[model samples]
Target chain A: MIAFGILAIVALIGGIGVIVARQPVHSALFLIVNIVALAIFYIILSAEFLAAAQVIVYAGAIMVLFLFVVTLLTAGKDDEEAGEELSGQRITAGVLAILAGGGLAVVGVLYPSQRIQLGLPQNFGNLRGMGDVLWGPDFVYLAAVALMLLTAAVGIMVLNRPPRKKADPEARLKERES
Target chain B: MMLLQVVLLVIKIVLLIAILMGGFAYTMLLERRLLGFFQLRLGPNRVGPGGFLQPIADGLKMVLKEDLMPDGADRFVYRLAPVIALFTALSVDAVIPFGAAIHIFGLTVYLDIANPSIGLLIAFAFSSLGVYGLVLGGWASQNKYSLLGGIRASAQIISYELAMGLAVMGVIMTTGTANLYKIVLYQQHHGWLWLPQIGAFIIYFITGIAETNRTPFDLPEAESELVAGYHTEYSGMRFASYYIAEYINMITVSGIAVTLFFGGWLGPWLPPIIWFFIKVAIFLFVFIWIRATLPRFRYDRLMNFGWKFLLPAALIYFLGTAVFVSGVL
Candidate 1:
């Protein structure tokens, strides 16, 4: 219980820091901390596979990508002032966040009797259990996810391809030679 | 009883940390001496007893030297980066079983720190987190070379990590467990998985080299290209943290290789701990040998090899092992 409380505090602070941090790199770091805290929550719940997957997939791969892009673009510099030209954007985001928080609080208050039990089964979140769900009835969903990722990769490749010109093949060859 | 257990746990952790620190120090001395031999030069022989005490001397030097931070650097993150690196490097050892549980004073003491159900994944996860140190250090230095080095390290790590993870999946499929000790036990019963999973072993070793940022994949700290790479501005003990982290990571990878493929602590006519150390030493020697022999890979070529070759090969090997294990092949 103490562990849970500590992780909760960490997660909450990380979430707030993600928005409050000045540098993009710091924000990404905060996001990583939040993800890691959530992973610890999974571990505390005995969802060991989920916890590991969360770290490997989310905090490891995805967050590395996030850090790469952030560093590439910003170089850890806070170039733009907070809420300078995005005053309305900030207000809209604030209002949406408040609405979501309130809605979740209301639902929790209304459904107090509908709270799920915390105890999980013997192999509830192990790899075998996850594989059964992913490869059994939900195989189509898995395939769909793979297909979607493949399509996105292809789309990015296409978008990134250099433009081709019909004229001056000899000139192009000479340019390359030079 | 609970207090006793807690005390045992603390003792185990302290012992492990002490052993690991000593191991890291010696491993550095060994590498330097070996590299000197490879290059036909005497390496740090002026230190006590044929440079046996060189690491101690090096540590003293590092501690006494000035710690410098660039004027424009982010002071906080600059300090935090090496801490993160070293922490992740050391923490991965929590899941690695050095030997089987032994009877001591009527209590069965497990050799490892933690034996989590998802041990292999935990190791990989912590290793993957090591990139943050390089990236943060480079970026926080506020130098162009550092930034480039950091970005390169991050990219290389990400690419190689996919291959490494997939390669390990092949072994996990055969063992039917992610627990390191269980994997070792399975190897003992079914013979070494490396015989059948040779491809995965090769891929794992290659990626392990890339993951640890050693030559020929040491582009992150490629001295000729980027001046000290991501650690360009670092000095003294702060720099030593990153250095120690790298060596510890090399040791961790060697431990993983031993656990996953070579049958951890399963040898004839020797104590389990001795067997484990022997295997790890062999792997460490191989790492240094490769560093001595191979020229560094070009940045683009390294990326290509990781993504184009290693990733696909690892994936196919993983799928093949999975299919075979499931009796679908």
Candidate 2:
């Protein structure tokens, strides 16, 4: 319990540190740090898979994309300037930000278990145990989920990566030649 | 156990975030060093001890840098895209576990955030949202190139992410759980999935690179072609945020490879944490090595690879492994 309290404190500190940091990159860096720590916290609660997925997917791939875009161009440190009034868009953005905050707040309030709890290792960090519990009786549900995953894998690939990059001239020529 | 769990989770978030942001700073240094090494030129050596303070200097420069918005741009979405991209990227860390728990003061500290059994799915969900950043950023920029870049990126990420998911599905089907830690443990019990699942891992790695817009798959930011891609109009620290986010994402993908294929933190002769880092580092090096070695695939070839080559192969591998595993089990 004492350790979780400390982790919560650290996450809060890191959260605040992100905004307080002078450099935009530093802020992003702080945010990334805060996230990784949060994943570790998830693990302490026996959510072992969550922690690994968090680090593996979130902390790893997405951030790399962000950096790739950021550095491919001019990266300066002067992003702290306030935006101009520029009509009601500013108000809209503020409203949207507030709405997001409100949503998080609502979720937080509703999910009290998500809050600081006493030793919360509902199960040990073992997938085999989870499988035994979740799939032992729920094999049908497991198969359903697997099917869903298969569909998601296929759907996203097809609908998104359409073969249109060469609809212009060269592709047509190659097609005709072939 | 439940009482102490919450307490321990709180501590882990703090440390993990600190480590990630800290690592982000250092990763900048590492990339610069590697870039200079590749270019056969000395990089920044003026900052703290061997340019180690370079990130610090860069940080100082960012706050002092200018923030500009182009005229006739969608002000709201433009700014919002970077924030969303950054947030989504950072959020993935919510699922990764670093080490075993230590029991102290009746509180056993967990080493991750949400150990959701479906954490692997959650990670992909966040990544799906990440493309919105590029799409929004490009659309908001109100420029043709930026818009095109955004279009390409959205298409690019959505495509590659699918292949990546299919590739990962191979692992989940074989291991029989979407839980990443279990996947790692599964590797430990069985041999490294990489040995048998080499095809899935390759496709996953390639798709991940494309998803992250790394070189040989970086048409979104193709300097000669797309200007600066989605952020052609961004300047100063807002721009810096994108840069930092990319390197961090690089680390993220590398971490995935470490976890999914390299038996994260399960190597002999080292503690789990050390093993995890070593594995992640090797993959990180691969990222740069690929950059230095391969030429960017033409846009059509990239799409073909995803659709013709990757998709079918991933599907076959996934189903084949599932049947094989189900029969064996």
Candidate 3:
């Protein structure tokens, strides 16, 4: 419980830092802190596989790409100098955030009994258990998620494909003859 | 009794750190001496018998030198980078089982620090995080070359990491566990996984070399182009920190490779820990041998090989392993 409290504070600070840090790279790093803290929370909850996956996927891979892109393109650039392209965006975002938070708070207060129990099964968080869950009854959901990610990747590839050059009629004839 | 256990653990940790530090120093000397021998030249032999004390002199010089922070550099991140590097490097050792459990004061303690179920994944996580140190150090240096080095290092590590992970899938599937200790025990009963999973071993070695940023894949610090790469702007102990991180990473990868494929800590007429170190030493020798034998890969060629060759090969091998493990073969 003490560990939970400390990690909760860390996660909150990291979350605040993500938005407050001026540099994009710094913000990405703060996001990593938040992600790592969340990963530890998974461990405390006895989700060892989930915790490792969380760090590997979020803090390790995704955040590295985020930092790579930010450092590559936004080095020395001041974030505040970029004027908002959408008018009244900040006000709209603030209102939406408050509404989301209020909704979540209401849900928590109304359904406190929905909380998960601390006791878990013996094989609840090992690799074998994860494998069984993914490949057993929940296989379809895993496949669906994987297929969606694949489709998105292929879509990006198509979008980024180089422009095709027009084939000359003479060159076509020569190629056919050859 | 509980307090004694805690104290013993603390002592074990301190001893491990000391051994690793000594290992790092000797490894550096070995690389230098071997590189000289490969080139038909005498290596550093002046400091002590056969250059044994060279690392001590080098350490002193590093500590005594001035620490430089470039103008306009991010001072906070600049200092934080080396700490991150050393921290991640050291932490990876926590999960590596170097020997069988031994009885001490009526307590059965394993030779490693922790024996988590996700031991392999923890090592992977730390290795993946290792890139941040180089990336941040390069970026904080405020030098364009340093930034380029950092970016290159991240891209290289990330690209090879996919194949590396896949390369170990065969062993993981065979053992049906990610626990390092279990993997080694399985190897002891069966033969070393390397003989059966030769392709995976080769892929792992190639990717490991690239991940370590060692020679042949040493483009991260390619002196010909990036001027010492990510650590170009760093000086003194900061520079040594990066150096130590690299060497320690080499040791960690070698340890993992031995644990996974080389029948770790298993041999005739030798202590388990001694056998483990011998295996790791051989891996280190191969690392240095490859350094001496091959030139650094061209940037495009490196990426092309990693993505085009290694990734597909690893995927195919992994699928085959899955089939075999499923009793389809």
Which tens-of-lDDT digit does each residue in A45-64 have in candidate 3? Answer: 78889888988888788888
**Worst-scoring 10-residue span by lDDT in model 3 chain B:** B7-16
- Per candidate, native contacts kept equal 0.71, 0.02, 0.49
Candidate with better DockQ, 1 vs 2: 1
Q: Judge candidate 1 at residue A3 and give its lDDT.
A: 93
* Model 2 stretches astray by more than 4 angstroms: A1-178, B1-7
Tens-place lDDT per residue, model 3, B1-329, is 89987987898889778978999999999999999999999889999999999999999999999999997798888999999999899999989998999887778989998899879998998888999999999888888889999999989988999999999988999998899999999998988999889999999999999999998999988999999999999999999999999999999999999999998898999999999999999999999999999999999999999999999999999999999999987
Off by over 4 Å in 1: A79-83, A95-113, A164-178
lDDT of 1 by residue, A39-128 (tens): 999888788898899999999999999999888988845546656664588789889999999999999889887657767776777788
Please give the range of 10 consecutive residues that has the lowest summed lDDT in model 1 chain B. B320-329
* TM-score of each candidate structure, all chains considered together: 0.95, 0.67, 0.95
Best prediction by DockQ: 1
DockQ of each: 0.71, 0.05, 0.59
Q: Which model scores highest in lDDT? A: 1
What CA RMSD would you report for each candidate? Answer: 2.3, 11.1, 3.0
lDDT of 1 by residue, B1-329 (tens): 89999999899899888988999999999999999999999988988899988999899999999999998898889999999999999999989999989998998888998998789999988988999999999999999899999999999999999999899989888988999999999988999878899999999999999999999999999999998899999999989999999999999999999999999999999999999999999999999999999999998899889999999999998888888999986
Clash totals, every prediction: 0, 75, 0
Error of 2 at B82 (Å): 0.4
